[model samples]
Target: MKMNLSCCLYLAMAFFSGPATIFALAPENEVTLHPTTWLGENKITAVHLPKGRTRRLYFTLKKKADLMSVTVSPCAVPIEWSLAVRTLKDKPPKKSHWTSKKSMPEVWWKGSGREVKIYTYTGNAVDTYTGPAYAPASIYILRLKSNERDTQVSAYLHEGPGPSGVFPELPPDPRVHTLGVGMTSVTLSWAPSSSVVVEEGQRGNRPYYEYCVLVNPKHNHRSLCAVREGSKKDENEQMRPGKELKKDWWWHQPDTPEDNESSSALWDNFEDPGCVCKDTESVCTVSDLLPDTQYYFDVFVVDKVNGTSVPYTGTFARTHEEARPAVTPLREGQVKWVNLNGDASSQNGERSFRFKPRGWQQNGLLTMHTCNGTGKVKVTVSTKGQELTTQEVGHELAQIWLHGGPSYLIQLQASHSDKSRFCLRMQASSAYHRRAVPVFPAMLQIKSFNRLRTCNSVTIAWMGTEERSLYCVYRRQIPHGSGKHSSTDRCLDPESRPASERVLCKYFQELDPRRAVTTAVISELDPGVLYVFDVYLMRRWGLPIKYHSKTLRTKSEC
Candidate 1:
């Protein structure tokens, strides 16, 4: 079915400003060095600096130098640090002659670990700098003194004057502010990543970046497969770990961070097609998730810079056993369940549950929670009772994929004679496919609002959203007879007034061409009278999405 998706584009609010330009890679000329003291133990070793040389850096550009400045980012330092930049002249400038003296700036990506400083230079002019000009052949010197021993640093010498030789760093790590955990979907929203200014002529540094999302099952949604019971045999009451699929268990990783114990093998890596963005945009919804399962979401932010941010653990969410459609507002905890085989005579007898889905895009899943009696439950579902799947139900939740279709029946029966009551539930979700939704579509927009044939006749087009089956075009003459673009400045509900007092035009959508879209027109009104037109897309589910209004006057019939 054709569904409107335009409404979803502007639903997110950015936490930070969008990115400016892309930072692909560091300049071709880059170097990373660790300073050493001559008195250090490794002084004579291959890595030691000369003795008595407290803190200094002497390096020559391997290639002819361009108008560039160097940025130094210290590594693994626990305290604050400061450094000075200088152009080493033939006479070797004294320590006090350094330019651009200041403490390094802190990087708050996740939390500040290291500090970085940028030393800029412009020909003849020491822009934001206090030192000499940058010549083609000039030796650079840096002096650093911090409580920390052996100042180790990574430096990037960005070639020639880029815009202010400064750009905003990677947007800070995104925080998941809103989360929708559905049986088969996880919708998330976060503030936009901050913007960065690139070199001259570069408008969008990094067009967009995507989140690398990975999930790990906190544990089985239901209790692990039942342990065979018996003390010694029956009394020993021995239970064993659930023999779930490798994908079901936590990944095993031999190497972990100092304090982290989670193994890498248990994690499920998902390529979130929705989470990818080319611009300063935030918000994504991931579908096709499992229900009743605990999942830890880990996300990494990748931006214009060639490097990727450290994985920031996201919220822990669990999918429900059932999903309620968003079309109509149903009472809380209200569920529609169809009886398959309501016969509850014996616990071992087959009990069937069935669900009819409204939309063709809906997929079905059956979940059963069996308590007390440890027993294996075999299930079959489809329009016909042909497919079969098995699960151990004693004291745990067992799920069966119904290979969704029109109407599916789920039949569950205990493998043995044990009496167990199976609490049943079903899940259904719509598979939405829309064309080219923008990374950020909130730039006050309407597909097109234009005056048709006459000022009194107008037509408007806008992006369609999921299940928005109807469009309402309403117009009421502006009070005080204001001209087009004048401030009508009032909220008048057209639906509240008499039919003659307002013109309400309803339009049904046609088959979409590329993206979901719809248009409606209003005509035959009095000529030259000022009017205000408001458009609302009536959704099949949930609330109607309203677009901005247009104020116009019909050309006078005179």
Candidate 2:
């Protein structure tokens, strides 16, 4: 989708209205920081702050902390920048300049060149009007702005003393496995990440964790699996209690605030092929993928509370290739039943059948029944490269409608790599077969009840002497020049309606020998309009047999 100039102007107008407006305009820009990022040392480096643009970062503290600190430093060429800290309850500053004396308390620093500045607060008291402060269960915002020219910078944050108890360790890499592969989807499963228990003497706490599956069409290097650069620290490199341990980003993080603004222009063309699983789920099915192509997957265990993640590498799979359809020949008035059985290992668990509506047979009906099998099957019907319908069935009868057409293709595949068994029966017939002769001259009669007739609808009922047969009802408005009372013994072909006529409704149904009558409601008619309805009995071969016809007019007023 292309955004015109007007759309860009509208977005700009909405962005400057308020923070809420900006968030609503570009929700993907809002990134949730992990608690570890604020409780422990975290460094965001090489962030490009474009001139005249402002960037804001947010973090929330769930528990009380004794100390909070933040540091901002310029990198490479010296540049002018300003930083400010605010809590959720603080109001927006009215002044435009960050260095104004009125903005001093709220603005942590306004510096030029390559100077580094650190802001700190201690204890539970929070100075809402001045300086960076600490408070339990509160959200804080760090706003940064660049002046003069665009430049890069690095920012750091730390809260101490960190949790007195042991910190939760990063989850170990998972063992990935491919359970099944389809033409457009792959099912994967892995062992759940082991729970990390934090112990403080007698009390123990377990942190919740979830999984995120990242998929790339091409292979990714193993080094890319680490969530943070230089995160694989040895025992000697581990930070001691109360000591800051900063982890920097070797590459830009997509979810960072600066990157979000810098990359906003490319959002319209980027597609992310990643999915998140529930905390308890170990199996996930990735779908809507290209067939006959290999894809790499990396699964990560994420700390739900802290938003930290650990990645598992070296997992990939390829989707199955589309199988060629098997053609089946149809004879006039003949019913055919075919059974298909296949295993995923050999057949990829997919089978397709194609049939042409030869002779006068233009209408077709298909019923699929799954036999005793280990997996369910999905059925898709298409023609001329256009898909008509699709459905999944198991151990039940599924009827599919094939509108009048020259040919149609039906594809069936198992949901997974397991033994599949399906029994399908198909029949083709014409709505107006010209060659078939009737066995009974007056076997069917169609009737309409006056009491059931409304201004816009009428009930049609039919009774037939023969059982085990299919019947179709068709309706069309009578042309202006035609007599309202005119009736015909010949049935009009619904597929070949004239320009003056239209097939308002065309549907077929099967009748059992034990049933005496079948009724249908034809609705959505114009007031006082005359319509002709034709009833035909379909045969397995040749043309359909015209059974009965009727003409009715809707009341002019209700």
Candidate 3:
């Protein structure tokens, strides 16, 4: 009696679903040995075993046989079940317990599924069954048990020298390729397995084949991908049953101490993302990947019904790095307007600028204002390789204080993916104050000199001749007991002096030379040493006028 494709599918579906109705009526402790008609016959039988229950089956050989094999295939569900087999001479134990090894018959062989056990008769006196007439017919008893939940299983009995190939062969290795790579996602495509069509033609029904895409960190030995229950699509496309296929499809390398040393190379710190696609769909997109990272991609074809899978074919791809524009140079006291209207903007919507204030413009403010964009812009200010402040600004102005000397990094990143226009203005805070008239005096002098001394530093305050003028303070150590007082006639520019006699020069802008006392601190001075300090009023056109020299001494070591 041959069954058509529809009948076979209906029978398979009924076999998987029919057990639920009889589950309540079946006795939990019943042990019945359902028998096959003759030996060396290939026969499959299905049984419904409730949770924490056991089922016994047997096949008898009229003549001595060299081999006896039994295979048990459980339902395609995430449940635990085991199979045990033994050969009995007369009858099985009346009250055999599945868990007690002593109470049950001695097991001749044990396996999960698709495994065969062979026995050969040796011509020796100790060999009990050396020939067909040496012993009575043998009975093979197969005991199966299910755990956690009610399970339906199919048992195949064979009395032969080899297996009958009850399970289907693994499909061909998939040829995987990358479709698109991104910072946090990767799109992949592959050709459908040809075996699916071939097998459906031969078997008269569609075989149960599932495809899974596994992603592992490059060069990693341990696998972080696992299949769990309800992870696959169900018949209704809502809730499907799933189980862990064989581990042969996973990529594994030698795990030495050297390989496990780096935490970044392992999946412990990150998620190893993967996905499952049907035989009809050849493309899938895996998300939540790290940027600028290399990964190994493996595509597996699993026989979901038989719990069999073949080795995977894999390839490697690297995600693209985050997009950023080149650092733009920003000039002090100037307003720069950036129009991200066309191709000038970065593709990732980020921009950065480098700014360094002039030596005289120490106290300044940096302002960022978005003029055309609707959403806010994220502004980050950093100086000397350290972040100073960050703010989100829109049409409202965002401002931060800027100091001179050290270069500053200002980054402007958009909060949304829309074309934007923004302006950055950097100006000295004093720019808002009243300006003093440019005046040149015939002579300049340093008046009202006072000093405060520390163990390694000295602070000197004086009144200069003109405001808004640049001053250069020079310091020189006097030789011990030399009593040499430096004269203004011999004073030279710090850069023009000889290497050995070059003095330290510090430049200060006298913003309020008339009212505010100009102060300068000279630090890292030698203790118990006298030093001479001279203030020069620098003139761009002519020679700088030198003020009276003053001597000061740092305190002795504490």
Candidate 4:
């Protein structure tokens, strides 16, 4: 059967942002020095700095370097660091010197047997540095030297998880913040470090970087699956971790089963599509998540320089099963509707009729209305059943308007099980559109009002009945005899294309707990025009009959 999807697009946009950009170091440039996992203890062994014997770094281009050394110093030791450089290609070997620029130079001793010293270099102008730790011993360094002649630099301290020099800062990492717990896998993202800066006759550096997102079990800390960056979609194969079909994106299974588990496995790794990005855009997908499992994820942004960003983590819990729709009771004085073919009509006291018939949408439409008036009126929202409400329902009716008719069945149910108290009723009308009707008549009321005056403007506000579903405002000219009624074409035409219809002046929505009534204020009305307004609580759209509020007029003063 046909269903309307016109409103679903807006909801989809709020769920997914986009893939994170992978920043690679320049071509042929190395960012990290760790050997593959097979390499034994692939860490730095020693750092030699003999007095008056300068340790020179001979590289083709200026690049940022991260040098770390294991240190054991008193908690009161004052530590200082700086940078130095020498041009091997320049004649006479010209050397430039500069002090390291860092705030809070004193690194605290964390009451440990050994502390690691980390030095960052940003500026490429200098050749060498002379600082407190310049002569430290057993220093292990991970340098990101560049391959180009001219460059820029800055020193940024490493923060968060993972060993230093293995990551770089990016945007998407901080933006996509939800983490699913107990789930097989999760996705993480960070913002890109650089976007192309356009200029005349200058081509910006553009290189595709690799991404390595890892997940470790929270308890034993065993490595799970590691998916590559670019991979094909294969759900069955991704159930467990192994060699992924994608380039850098991979999938991993937890070393141990989750303590509090759900049914399905996690589809954590999503390789972004790049060919579409040649035109400057791309798409990535992550699937196969465990049902009702929670997972923590960390993303690494890698580039050709081997620069990776520190891990950004978040958590989310999957549902055991997809949610199914169910009918909920309506609020007091509110009405709902379900349209069948135009065969039934309201007469005498038998105002309501059952609408559970086959082929309803193709053959006709069902309509339901609720009376929200201050005093009780005959409310007949559903012919099948009815209920009273003091607040709105969490879920409302959904509609799908599409061409090429499809046949479907429509079912109408009561708000409450009480059948004798038929406070609401329904009647079949010639209206083109149909909706859900209420079972009882409503008594509408103006709940509250507010007034404000400022140097530049004046405003009036009002509260609606607690059962209100929709609200609107209107204006009228005060009665004047022999007073000049300037006819400057003040009437606003409500019929333009949907693209230009401004009839809906203001609106607000709350989906978590559907409370019906809302407050609104009108602005920019002329000082001379008498403004009138009203609010309504209708259960369905396009049912013109309303349980409307008492018209309140405002004094025009600005």
Q: Compare the candidates by lDDT and give the number of the best one.
A: 2
Per-model TM-score on C-alpha atoms: 0.26, 0.26, 0.37, 0.22
* Residues 367-480, model 4: lDDT tens digits: 333222111222223322333222221122122221123322222323332223232222222213434332222334444343453222234343333333444443334453
CA RMSD, predictions in order: 36.3, 26.2, 21.8, 32.3
Model 3 C-alpha RMSD to native: 21.8
Off by over 4 Å in 3: 1-166, 171-197, 200-226, 230-277, 280-337, 340-349, 353-377, 381-388, 392-409, 414-420, 426-558
lDDT of 3 by residue, 244-344 (tens): 43221232322444323432332332221343434435677777777898877766554444433333456778999976678988765545655443223
Off by over 4 Å in 4: 1-167, 170-175, 178-189, 194-206, 210-296, 304-309, 317-321, 325-558
- Using TM-score as the measure, which candidate wins? 3
- Write the number of the candidate with greater TM-score, choosing between 2 and 3: 3
Q: Which stretches of model 1 miss by more than 4 angstroms? A: 1-173, 196-208, 211-281, 298-301, 304-313, 321-558
Give the clash count for each candidate.
36, 4, 0, 124
lDDT for model 2: 0.53
Residue 547 of candidate 3: its Cα lDDT? 64
> What C-alpha lDDT do the candidate models reach, one value each?
0.39, 0.53, 0.52, 0.29
RMSD of 1: 36.3
Q: How accurate is candidate 3 locally (lDDT)?
A: 0.52
lDDT of 1: 0.39
Residue range 1-558, candidate 1, lDDT tens digits: 123454343332221222211112333333323322221110111122222244554433434435544443332332232233333223322432122122111111122233223343212110122222353233444444335444333334344344222323333654554367778777766544343223212654424333444344541110000000100122222233543322221222212252122212112231111122223335566566688876655444433333322223266677788532122222212232222222334532555555654445544334444322344455555465555455454333333444435656555555565343433332332223322211211222454454363755766566654332566666667655343464322222233445764455565533443455666666786777777666655433222334566766667863
TM-score for candidate 2, residues paired by index: 0.26
Error at 302, model 3, angstroms: 5.8
lDDT of 2 at 320: 93
